[model samples]
Each structure stands twice: as structure tokens, then as C-alpha cells.
Target: METSWEEILEEVSKQIPPKYFTNFIAPLHFVRWEGNQMVVSAPSQIIKSHVEAKYANFLENAAYQIKGDSFRLVLLTDKEESTSHMKDAIENRFQNSEPELNSEYNFETYIVSDCNRLAFTAAKSICEHPGKYNPLYLFGPVGVGKTHLLHAIGNEIKKKDPWKTIRYVDSISFLNEFIFTVRQNNRDSLESFKMRYQSYNVLLFDDIQFLNGGAEKTQEEFFALFNFLYERKRQIVIASDRPSYELPLHDRLKSRFVHGLQADVKEHDLSLRKELLRSYTIQYNIPISEETLEWLAQNCDGDSRALIGIVNDLVLYKKAYQFFLLSDEKIREIANSRLQTNRKRIGFNPDQVIDLVCEKLNVARKDILGKSRKVDFILPRHLCMLLLHEILGLPKAQIGRIFSAQHTTVIHGITKIKEKFSEDKNLFDLYQSIKHQISFQ
Candidate 1:
């Protein structure tokens, strides 16, 4: 007897979380089985790629368990199936063709503020007038919207002129393609690789920092391609986690990167976080109150990704529980739980917290951990206790051990900082600043 798709999905659902199954797996439709291959259709290319990359193994395992044999999984989208032969021919001819731009990451969806204004403006300018910035360099910390801007540039340009050739690729993919081309050991293959990249009217490169770390041949090839694109007056956009000067590439490549406009997106501020949260709540239709949103914006640390993730979790939770309204206390509990989970993932130690407090407050380490009751020492000491308890999620007793004080004293110190956070603006700013530094570190 042949196993049905329903049976396979039922088996897979037991292994996957409910939310994941609903969001990713449920949208898939099993088409048919050919010999040892199981065919599936996804609603969109994004879903198809995500399932192939992430959940295909689970599906394969489930099918094996049900059928008592191993079967390969083949995923396709509706659009691909309509022109399968032609698509395959085109792919074979140009194996390194441009990838699909994420439609969700356009400029309109991107949140702009003082934090990312320069990069956003430069990216928009590139869309309006290609090759103007020549090679726009966008650098910032992780999850700070650099990649979004890269895709936005490509999407906007494509929207304006569908005829323009655009290629959006990361450094790793570029290196991998180059490596594959070289292994062919044919001059024609090498020339094809160069021509493919050079043919693009606009190139949006992401995570260029990955090109560092002894990929000298790749760097040389990239330098040659960079010169090709620049001399041809084609547009190029690059994003990295740090500035061009900080990348360990050849000086020539670094100089080329900086010759054009360079902009950076900083970490999200409180207002930015609130705006992001509001956007996400509206996007997902999560029935969160303004007060809860403010609390989340103030308490949730990290980049926009973190904020969006928490909102997603809330959406899932609301759906699972069938709750129409989330109370303030319940929201606080959820936020605290999320913070605790973040604490485990962040792996910040009490010592690092103490070091940051001392450095930021301009007090010596000994003074923080000592019996000093000076006015300056009090604020730093109190701030350190609050951070350890709130940011690190350290228990009062454990934090007390770090300071050689009783648990009650630790509680009092944290309470003092929380009280001052309401009354003292300077202290509140200092606390927020230190927290920001800790988050980036």
C-alpha cells in the first residue's frame, strides 16, 4: 500500500512544532511520487526554498518511516512547474543566474530613522539614479537593515526598469561560484563566469566581509570584476558588518569600496523599537496594547529582528491560546520569559556586566565590588546590580555573591536603580547607554 501525503504530514507534524507546521509545512501540497522521488509544490519560491533548505530532511524522514524506504524530495513552485523545461535549459546555460529578490524587503517596508537615514537615502538615490554612488558601501552591525537596503535597491531598480539586469548575491555565494568555475579547469568556463557577473547592470553584494580570511584568489577575481563594473559605469552596492577600512581585504579592494558613498545603520533606539513593534503588530494583526508595546520596546534588547521575533511569538501564542485580549500582567510575563531566553542565548556573564558598568560610569572595578558608599560609586554599583539582574537574569543571591553583599542588599540596589529610572533622566540615559553597549558587545 502507498502512504498518503496526509499520513506523511501527520508524522512530520508530530516532530515539528505546531507554529512551524502551520506557517511552513501546511502550505505545501504533495504532487506525486516518481520511483524514489517524492514531488511537492510550494505556494511561492520563498516557501519552496525555505522548505528545501530547512524542512526537507524532516519530510524525507517521515516519508521513509511510513513507506519503509528512503525517498528523495523534490520541491517546486507553481511558476516553475509551468515552464519546467525552459527553466531547466536556462539554468543549465547560466548556472549562476541572479537569485530572486525578496519582495518583502523593499524600501517601503524598511523603517527609516536617524539611525539608518544616510544608508536609506543613499540606497534610494541609487534606485533613482543608478551608478551615481557607483559602489555604495553600507556597513553596520548584525540585523541593522544593511541586507534589507541591498535587496531594496535591487527591487526598486527592477520595479522602475524591468529590462535592467540585476544580480543580488552574498560574498559566500560569489566565492562558491568562483570555486566551482575554477574546478572545471576550462578557460571557457572561467570566461563565462566573468561575463556572467560583468553582464549585470546593477550588482548588490551582501556580507562582503566574508570575502576576507585568506580567499586571495577570490579577492583578486572580485577586484577584476569590480574594475569591470566600475569602468563600465554599472551600479554596485555592497553591505558589511563593519567599515571598508576595517575589512581585511587588499588595499585596492578597500579603496574601491570607499571611493563611493559609505553609510551605516546603527542599532535601534527606543523610539525606533517602538515604531518597529507597532509596524509588526499592525502587519501581523497582533492585538497588543500601546502600554504593552511601550514596555516591550523599553525592555526588549537587540536589533529589529529580535523585536519582530518576539512579536511573531506573541502572534503564535495568541492563536494557540485563542485569547482575544492579552492583559498587561500576562504580557509582562511573556516579555520577561522572552528576556530570560535571550539571556541564555546571549551568554553574558556577571563579570562582563560589572566591567561595562565600571567603564561607562568611570569607576574602578574595585570600587564597584568594594564597600564604597560614595555618591558616584552608589549609582554605578546600583546600575551594575540592576543590569546583572535584568540583563543577565542573574539571581539576587548569585549577584549578591558577586558583590559580597546579602541578597536583600542586591534587591535594594536593583530597586533603587528602577526608582531612579523613573525620576532621574540622566541616570536613565546612562543606564540605557550602558545597556546598548552591552547588547552590541
Candidate 2:
């Protein structure tokens, strides 16, 4: 008797956890059998890597139980499909499925600091009583906990009311799905899209600042859905790298975002970073001292993501080296190798940064101070501001005084240069040159 692929997967599910099955295995599609090999498809590369890393053993055991040990298993992402038939099959499989939110992003796991305390409290409050903080606007720099809190809100809401329809989407996914539906041109497909969104009791939209490119159409579509949800008192939460007013949307849309409980997650302070590092150390049961932990927290610039990465790397290094007692030298070596932790210690005054930029870009001190926005002077002026704030750690207000501009203007200049780094090679190279000189100075 021969067994089917579904039967093999069913056996595997019995051995694996339920959450793993639903979040990972359930979305997979068994594509085909190529000679003595079987190929499976996951919706995206992330899913493929996750399934391969965590579920390989269960899959192998299931395959052996169902068929003899002669068969080989292969996994591929939807984009990896070679044939049009496979592409169609994969597309159909991906349709009508919501992107899975990480179960790990619950309130229990989130570490609250003064930096994100208000955002955290507001998230909990909204979950306890939905729609009160309708359109809770969260804004922060990258790798801060904006997205984490967004998912946490969704997870908590679903836990409290299992029957409620909750959806979590980044603006990019929302934009892509809407564009796809519009292109389909089928009335039923468009209606299905409307029904899906309108049915959600809670919608967690992350990185709404990226909600540009197809500004008018997508913005209008989202604005309509937002209005529908808001009118019905369905909870809506949005996270972005900048405030709603800073987003490149119509004033109408921005006004809606501003009407909510707007909160900002600042960069983690030293105490908060120490708390986070200590929490991780305890979780892993690593035998590091308070002194080293404090030193680590003080050395880093309070970026939670970088601090967490260091913790992971330190643990791995400790295990590999089998060090009985970790030393300052060993930790510093690890920091140097893993993080470019050396550049941060070098100090230069804001005046030095301004002087360096002027020399490099062939601009004058008076020109930079004067109210001139010449093509030549603008780059140097922006670079001086950016370098002053980033390198010397000067306050934006202090940097603004150099150019006789408002603090907001200084911020805007830095932001524009940062965004241009991705698209303009000349601008990026100039930034790097200025940065290197400042770092070494």
C-alpha cells in the first residue's frame, strides 16, 4: 500500500507542536514528486528557512514512517518555482491566507523601559478596552519596539476574545495586496478584499511611513477602509518610523492619524539597556557579573537590537571558548570583532565637524552660517549638521544654531541625507568620507 504526502504531513503534525504546525507547516504546499525526490513549497523565503531549521527532524521521521528511506525531500519558496504551472499552484496556495504574527511578541515577553513605557501601557489599555485608543499612533526610529508593541496588542486582543477577527500587516504588504486586487479586475476579488479587511475587529498596521510610491490610490483605498473601521469602533493601531504628520500623505489622512493617542518610543537609555541585557543573561542562565553587564550597557549607544545581538554573540562565544570567567579584555575583543565598537569612543567637537565638512566640500564658515541654500553649500551644511548630531552627540538645537535654521529644519536635512544614502552614490560616498574623517578625528 502507498501513502500520500498529506498522510506523511499528518503524521509529522502529530509529533510537532500545534503552533508550529499552524504557523509553519499548515501553509506549505506539496508541489510534486521529481523522480525519487519530493518538493514542497513555502510562501516566502523566511517561511522556507524557518521550516527547514526547526521542522527538519519531524519531516524526516514522518517521511521514513510513510515511505521507505529511499526518497529525498526538497524545499523551495514560491519565487523559486521554475514552471508556470507551479507558479499558479503556489499563488493559489498563498491567496486568502493572513501573514502569521509572531507568537513570541506577547506582553509577557516584552521588557518595558521608560523609553517605551507609555506606548506599552497604552497598548495594554487598548487590548483591555478596544476602540478607546482607536488608531493608536506609535512612532520611533528603526529597530525600536514599535512593531513589537503593535503585534503584542494584536496578540493580547485575540487572547482576550478568540472570536474577534484580528489582522496584522505592514504598509508594504497592505499596498501590495491592494494593488494585486485592483489588477485582478474581478468584481468578486475586489469584494472579497473589502470583506476581508472590513471583517477585522483589530487591524495592526506597521511602518505606515512606507505607505508611499502609489500615494494617491493606495492612500485613498486605505483611508476608506480606515474610515469604515473607525466609524464602526473597530480598533486600529499603526506604527511608523516618523510621526503621522511627517508621512508623505494627504492632510486628511494625517489628521485622522493625529486624532489618536500618539506615542513615541525613544532610544533605550542606559538603565533600560542594562535591564534588557540583564534579562537576556538571566534567560540564558549565563554567569556574567553585574559589573560586566553594566559596562556592556554603558558602552553601547542604547540600540536594543545591537545590544541583543551582542548578547547572542557573547553567549555563543562563551560556549565555544568554554571560558570559566569572562574578562573585560575578552568582552572588548568580542565587541571589537562583532560590533565596530571602537569608532564610538573617539570624540570630536561640533566645530571640528563643521570645519571638516567645509574643507571637504570646499565651502566657507560664513557661507554655512549665512542663509544661502546653494547646490554646493547645501550638502556641506547638511553633512555638518548630521555629523555634529551623530558624531559629537550635539543636540539638534545646538546644531541648528550653526546654520541659523530651526531645529526641525536641521532634523529634516539629516533625514533627507539619510534617505538619499540608498539612492545617490555620490551623496552616500560623501557621507562616508565625512563620517570616516570625523570618526578618526
Candidate 3:
């Protein structure tokens, strides 16, 4: 008797581990459903061998037990591996479900760095095994790879487990949705959102630090959501500019985040930057030089998106109508210009500086300018005062007046900054730039 395709799938799935079904068969391609036989395509020959060697008997026995021993499982690769249909499906689904995550932000395109490498590997780990890492947290500076990592993980998880439901959104977006859900106050809407979170095999929230208004209510709700999914062994991942502790999070909320595996993404180091530039060069079909890449890497710092932007600008700057021409000097100039422009743009006032320096250096603005001489706030406090004094060239007394301290206090700040200048060249450069930015006269 000829077995139907539906029967063939039903019997096969029953024999395979229910948990592994999504992990294994979802990646397997249902290439063609011809009469009596099903042509499946594995991702690679290795996958084909594993299925055949390990699971083939189970599959064959399933066919015989359910319907008949007539259906054959032919694992093909040539046609289905082309990725045209899969790519379209992924792109279309993204367009519908998560439009903000750019379709281009896939694992193939992400740049791995020491800062983000552990986090990258962890995300990949969870993608491979959904329940292993609960509430994956990754934090770093702006323009870092946090969002890229989230997108890459989403795309990869989708590819690895096509049958599994996945949800990825930024924390701010989630916050807005959460607020609306609260406003609606409908049991069904709330339940539906909760179900979506709980039922999703993988859930990723970007910029989780945005949860950081330290608002008791929002944090409470999110904490519940995180706990609920975490308990079920479902995957929960988040990305933020900084870790939970670094931000002013409530103690309860803070404990939930740090309890999970968290990694700080490193700034873009030289080698990773080179790899990133090379990838962009290929994407734009341009031929960039090693020298240019080195220069860009040295100057562009840790932001890969910024590097890509530099590449696009280089393409336009080249102005070659026929084809993309990558030049060494052009890439360098673009990178340097961007770095300088960005560095030159960080703005603040005396009050803002005092507030920030006080917090970062863990000192009070008053003590910073006061005669406390307490080394605790002394270094950073003095550093800020020195920056103001040197850059603004404010009279010691006038600058002291702003911080409500003696003119001698301002003088002391300037002296400390100079003393630390050689030991911390980068710090000095930063002070000079800050001075430059605030220079009105």
C-alpha cells in the first residue's frame, strides 16, 4: 500500500525525540514531496550523514510502522541549499514580525571581538540549545555590537529551528508595548502577550538597560516575564549598553540580571576591525587594501557599524561610476574624520560635568572642588576642574565659584590633571578635546 506524505511525517516525528524535532528536522529541508517518497535536503553532507547513520533506522521503522515500508528519505543538497526561498521567507517574516531588526544583521555579517566574543559564543550556544542560558545579558557602549548580536542570534535561531517561534525586540519597544498592554487592562491582551513571551522558544530583548528608569512597576512586570520564561527552560536574551549593576537598577531586578551569564563586549580591537572592513568591502563589491583596513581599525575603535558607515562614505567619496573602487587613503581619511567629529561632539556644561564626574569617580561635586583632599573624589574631581580651568581658561576664582569652592581648588584640579597627563596620555587627550569643545573664546 502506498503511504501518504502526511502519514510519513507523523510517524517519523513520533519516533524522533520531541525536543530534538525542532533542532534537527527544522534545519532539514523538505525539498520535494513527490508521490510515495519525500526528498529531504540536509544543510550539509555532514548533517546528511548524521541523520542517515544515527536516525535513519528510526525514520525507516517509523515509515513501516505507521503506513508502509514504501516511502524513501532521499537527502538532497544541490537544489535546496541555494537559500533563495529560505532567504525570502526569512526576509518576509522579518518584514512582518520585526521590521526594525535589519535583514542584513545576520550571523554571517557580525564582527566578533574580545569584548563580545564570550557573549557571541553564549548566544550561539543558546541558539543551539535553547534552554541552556537563561536571560542572556550583553552590555557595552553605544554603537557596539549589542543589537547586531541580538539580530544575528535571532536569524541563526530561526535558521536552526525554523519551527520554533522567536521574538526579538528592543527594550524601549517592549516598554511601549508593555505600557499599552497595561493601559488596555484587558485580561486577554495581557494573557496573549504573556503567552507570546512564555511560548516563544527563544525571546531576545535588545537594550534591556532601557528597562532602567528604575520604575518599580515596569521592572516588576519584566522581572515576572523573565522569571516565567526562565523557569520553563525557554531562552531569554538581552543586550544593553552597560551591565545591570552599572545602571541604577533596583536590587531585586539587579539580582535577576547578574545571576545569569553576562559579558561585557570589548571595544573593536585591530584584528576584528580588519575582518569587519573586509566583509563590508565584499558586500559593497569593492577592493579595499590591507593598509586601509589597518588604518581604519586603528582609528575607528570598537564600533563596527561606524566602520561600515565609513566604508559607504568611502564608496561615495570614490565617485567611480563603473564599479566600487576601494582606496587606502580614502578609507583612512573617512575613519579619522568620523573619529574626530564624534570625539569633538560630546557636549556638556559645568554642572553636567560635575554630576557625571562625581558619579563616575564616585565623589561629590562639592568635595571635588572642596579642600577635602580626599583621594576618593580627588582625582576625578580635580580632573574635571582642571579640564574646565585649562580649556575654559576660567580664572581660578571664577571656576571655583561655579563649584562653590575656593579659587585654589580650581588651581589644584589643573595641577592634578597635568600630573596625571603623562601617566594617562589618553586621559589628557580627552581633557584637551573636552576643553576644545567647550572653548567659546
Report the lDDT tens digits of candidate 3 across residue range 1-441. 134445655676877787666666546656665576666777777778778777766665666666655667776664555654665564354335654446688776777766568878887787777777677888877876887888787788788778877787777767766666676568986776677667777778877767776556777878888888788887888787776776666777778776567877765656777788888878876686777666565555446777778777767766754445645665666667765555433355567666656665566667776667666766777777776544433334456667677644555566667768868888777666555545542
Tell me the whole-model lDDT of each prediction, alpha carbons only.
0.84, 0.79, 0.68
Q: How well is each residue in 211-288 modelled by candidate 2, as lDDT tens digits? A: 884567899989999999999999999998887777888888889987669888876766777888888878776667
Worst 10 residues of 2 by lDDT: 336-345
For every candidate in turn, the CA RMSD to the true structure comes to 16.0, 13.6, 19.3
User: In model 3, where is the ten-residue run with the lowest total lDDT?
Assistant: 388-397
The digit string of per-residue lDDT tens for model 1 on 369-407 reads 999899889889999988886667665556778899976
Candidate 3: segments with Cα more than 4 A from true spot: 1-103, 320-327, 330-340, 343-441
Best by lDDT: 1
Query: Looking at model 2, how many pairs of residues clash?
Result: 0
10 residues in a row with least lDDT, candidate 1: 85-94
Top candidate when judged by TM-score against the true structure: 2
Q: What is the lDDT of residue 191 in candidate 2?
A: 85
Looking at model 2, residue 196 earns an lDDT score of: 84
Sort by lDDT, top down from the best: 1, 2, 3
Runs of candidate 2 exceeding 4 Å displacement: 1-96, 341-354, 357-441
Sorted on TM-score, highest at the top, how do the candidates line up? 2, 1, 3
Total backbone collisions, model 1: 0
